[model samples]
Target: MPGFDGACTVNESVKIDHPKLVKLLQLAYSAEKAAAFAYIGHAGSVRNPDEKVAIKQIEMDEWQHRETVLSIMGQYHIPTSRYYEIKYHIIGRIISCSCYVIGWFMPYYFAGRLE
Candidate 1:
């Protein structure tokens, strides 16, 4: 359908075996998997009523993303690990992502950029 956003995309071709393609795919897959787990953990820990609902919705999205990643990996017979070790680097990433979201929206909420 026309004007369906990404339902149809430009058929721009690129080499599938390109290193950059592989790197980007790996990054996206890792982020989705991490987000799924993080949302699950947060959903379990959150106590506020409205926040609980919002978190659950976000968790569902992350779960869907994880499933899509695994489905794509399945085509290549790639293994998707359910038990990967997380290091301190992940904690830093978590903080960074949180900060990014807060930073992006806080200014809009405040109606001005914060200095």
Candidate 2:
């Protein structure tokens, strides 16, 4: 919805041998794993009961996705990203505990929590 779009055509009619495709696939899987980790980490800080439940559901989905990625990665010998930094970890913990656990007033997710 925001980034520039690019178009590329791949002709499957001809058989092509390429070594770069392996690196490309590995990078793609690495990105997927990073995304899954970010979402799972976000779910940990959800406050509302319903939101927490929804996030947990998504966490399960992320786990399954990671398993699939790992399985595919094993075949290609592609190593996954060891860690993904969650920039929101501190704010998330504060908000989740305040609004849900302790019931203290807390800012919403869409608020200026980017810091």
Best of the candidates, lDDT: 1
Query: Any runs in candidate 1 off by more than 4 Å, and if so which?
Result: 1-15, 76-115
Q: Highest TM-score among the candidates is held by which one?
A: 1
lDDT by residue for model 1 over 3-110, one digit each (tens)?
677665555443455656554455556666555555544544556788768867875776587578666665554554433324322742463345334543422232
Error of 2 at 8 (Å): 36
TM-score computed on alpha carbons, candidate 1:
0.48
Per-residue CA lDDT of model 2 for 1-115, tens digit only, reads: 5674775565323322455754454444444444444444455556667876775676566457657766665656655543322333343344444544433223333222221
For each candidate in turn, the TM-score is 0.48, 0.42
lDDT of 2: 0.47
Where's the lowest-lDDT run of ten residues in candidate 1? 106-115
